[model samples]
Target: MVKGIPVSFGVGIARAVCLSAKETQAVHVDSQPANVEQELKKLHDSIERSTAELNRLHEQVSQEIGAAEAAILDAHLAFLQDPAFAGEMKTQIQEQQLYAVQAVQQVMEHFAAIFESLDDSYMRERAADVRDVGKRMIKNINNPEGDAQEAYTEPFVLVAEDVTPSDTISLPRQLVRAIVAAKGGATSHAAILARSLGIPAVMGAGPELLTQTANGDLVIVDGTSGSIHINPDEETLARYQKQAERERAEMEQLEKLRDLPAQTTDGRRIELVANIGRPEETEAVLAKGAEGVGLFRSEFLFMDREQLPTEEEQFAAYRDAISGMAGKPVIIRTLDVGGDKHLPYLDMPKEENPFLGWRAIRISLDRIDLFKEQLRAILRASAFGKALIMFPMISHVEQIRRAKGLVEEVKQELRQEGIAFDEAIPLGIMIEIPAACLIADALAAEVDFFSIGTNDLVQYTLAVDRMNERLSDLYSYFHPAVLRLIQQVIDASHRNGIWTGMCGEMAADPLAAPLLLGMGLDEFSCNANSLPRVKEQIRRMSYESAQEVAKNALALSTPDEVKTYLASL
Candidate 1:
């Protein structure tokens, strides 16, 4: 009778001790004046004790959600120490005739408002963290009973209207069997964290979930299937328990293969690269045997928060990511935010079709100062590791030329400052737009590499939005035009002595593996988890066989022919 998204599979018979993040605290403030400073001190001391714990939470989450996201609290540590933010709070209470607690509350909400309105989910989550720290501080001031972080002690499932990144920090990990939420789709940070932690989670159950389930009731969750069951009987519970154990075992078996090489039977090799958001993610890539980072989306540095991150903040992130790779290649893609990937700092107007609106390099060029600051950060970080500078959504030769000019300008400035950098760092462009693919040969001569963004390429080529499940079937990476465009890019890159790689979902598909192998792609960078299976397929065939299949397939006109060829293989 309960409704909620079921993120994980399996059933366990246990008493429910529900821990909901949306539950608010009354946050009593002591009335004594000079005595209140003593209480405020007690609260500050509580915050001080919790700081170390909060940081540990940050690292635990970093392990699950990438280091960059984990570092959100890292900046908060600095804010806690900030004379400006702290001084304003004290000033509001002492000089403006506001209560000490109200002063902190107002200060926090002021900052929280800036983040909550931002277009970036990463940034929006920070508002929740600010709220978290603020409320914790208030609880500390009040010396509330049984509020010692671990209020939830028994094994149970956590259901919430929504789960913010901060909600996971101290959520009684030992007690939480799985996560179920009424909101959040796949791209939400909550879903991403659940996936990383291998936790069963269901999201987007809607308002119906509010009343269906209650505390102290047995429930079943199937994360893999996204199903939830209320008051599942003994037989059902036993069956789901088996399913949970089996799936957990399978996941463990996969983890062991994390660092193994991804090579095909015939000796064709493909790169297993991690898609990351920050410099800290390099550690995960290295642990997973990622040849390198294929996509380092830099938008997190720009989106979700009030103002753009300082150059030093951005530089540290970039430097850490590259350094974490330990001399392995790190392809850094600059701000790919706008449209659906919106950043609040830019104040971009709402559009009917954000996908077709100003995004990626289009926004970068429009705000040259922000663009140049990023270039400087990349160049500065280049001294720390093997960093490749890449531009996204490039559609014209002039755009490439102008971007190169900015890079040159940044390099010149660095040279004047005597900073070390890979001035010869490879510059690559994403072949996503239809125009860029059509002019592949011309573009090939200008850039160091070409990475097929098949997600966008297929969307653009087929005139379908891949995000729209209704139009998903129409989104074919094997369309004749898509194949011919890929061929053009590959042939042109080979001709120009530049490398061509595929970083899109297509690169991970076993069926597309041989076709790409034959077409002569220099690198096949894909999700780190898919490496072995794709490698096994590549090992089964030779370069010549893949080439022939690719040739024959390209000559065919339909997606069915291409799929048939792959299936026959």
Candidate 2:
């Protein structure tokens, strides 16, 4: 059995179909091409062919899956049209006298290497996109007749070093029961596509996965637990088969509770919402029975592109999300860039400790013009539906004042321009920093609501890097210190007449649901996939019992104690 990170949840049992990485590797040509013009023409023709193919794929994905999933292809298309990308290949073909295919391979690999060197994980994943496009163009140039799509006569588990976004979309959904990759994270475009398509996936299983597993080998994929078993014993296989059936039964049961309120047996209600990055993701949020959107990660719009998204572009994206929610409150967190999310277009300096250094609200405050543009877009989108603006990583009261001041300025400008907007759109801040939680009352008074970003709050409080695999055990949201801070923030919000919502991974956890509910957390926001189960858990217990659970949990000395106690209940 091999362990990996679970990206999508489901159980898959099938024969392993290991996809070789050799095909995607760059092949250099030793001899220079005699005809430079002809080589350039081949490169240009390949780009055009790849572009047309991508267009067809975009339409097919939109019809079969969703517009949001299909939008990834648009980014690929942008790369094809990008001067830096194509022009760099042209330079290699002409000056270096490299063959068109060889130039595409070399240039794409060079760019992918640069992306992989970046500190940010999200930016590094983009290296796959660069390679994906290059592979498409290479295939186009070599086989103009078009390569035949791989057909599967039986369901199988796709084992690869890493599955690209295009490959993920192009796979026959019925035949590919699960995906087990040697590399990738949950946020990778391929993983996101898998989740949207409801396929089970376990990524980053390490190099051993490729070496040990062979085609036709029986594989059991427990995506929920990130476990992969190759050629399991009969007894083990039977147990997994039973577990899979049980999971299917539980899913059917959860579906019945979709329209039900996330209310305790004693009639205490909590708002269950979803965190979305793009407008099209609102479809999954609503489908999962989210009462509203708790956190709209607007930073995604800024990343994976050449330049900052214009005000009109930002406004259209925000507007579409608001419209999709259909009057349900949508909280849009403004531009939380820097620290793991780097924008190449933005000339940010290299930082020693990025998380502690220039990031989030600090960057926004320094670049007020950029801040104001995002504010204008959010406010403009508010005119269409219920839109609320939230600022991230605020530690001091001055940051809140400065950010709110900008919002007011944008509102005034919109008013003078005869634009319609929600004048009373609720403004809020993410209570992530330890300083923010300590003075939550002061911060709460300045905003309509507070959303506890536990992911950062835990890391900052424990002085642990959440991304460090070695320190993962130390970075627990269930730690007494983290819980105390969460309780403090919620208590302060109530004291200041503002409600507090939690938009973090902890919100989706069933173990934490009872404690959070008991703490009087007004809202619980998480990934769309986890919503139904969270709601179901809340509905089963009494408010009084949850309160008692919270009291006991707060008294616990360690994270393990808290988790153990919660599990017992």
lDDT of each: 0.72, 0.86
Task: Report model 1's TM-score to 2 decimal places.
Answer: 0.65
Residue 338 in model 2: lDDT: 77
- Candidate 1 residues lying further than 4 Å off, grouped into runs, are 1-16, 21-23, 27-56, 71-155, 172-175, 233-239, 265-267, 277-281, 297-327, 334-386, 405-424, 431-442, 452-569
| lDDT per residue (tens digit) for residues 1-569 in model 1 | 44444333334335444554322343554554434464356545655754765677776765655654565555555556656656677767566555546767787788889888875444565675676666655555445344555367578777777765556555665667777777765445565556555456777777766567788777777764567776787788888888878756855765766666666546656666667776666665676667888878788777546788988989998998888888888889988876556555578887757778888998889889999999999999999988998899999999999999999998999999998888789999999988897788899889999888998898888887664433434678888888888888888888888888888868866678888888888787765545544565666678778888888998897997888877787
The candidate that wins on lDDT is 2
**lDDT (tens digit, per residue) of candidate 2 on 1-569:** 99988778789999998875444444555564547998888888989988988988887866555554666776688789889999999999889888888889989999999988987544565687899999988877766676545557899999988888888888888788899998876667787788767789998899999988999999999887789999999999999999889978988999999999999999998999998877887887888899999998898788767899999999999999999999999999999877766777899888767788888899999999999999999999999999999999999999999998999999999999999999999999999999999989889889999999998898899988776544555878999999999999999999989999999879977778999998889999987777887898899999999989999999999998998899798
Top candidate when judged by TM-score against the true structure: 2
- At residue 11, candidate 2 shows an lDDT of 93
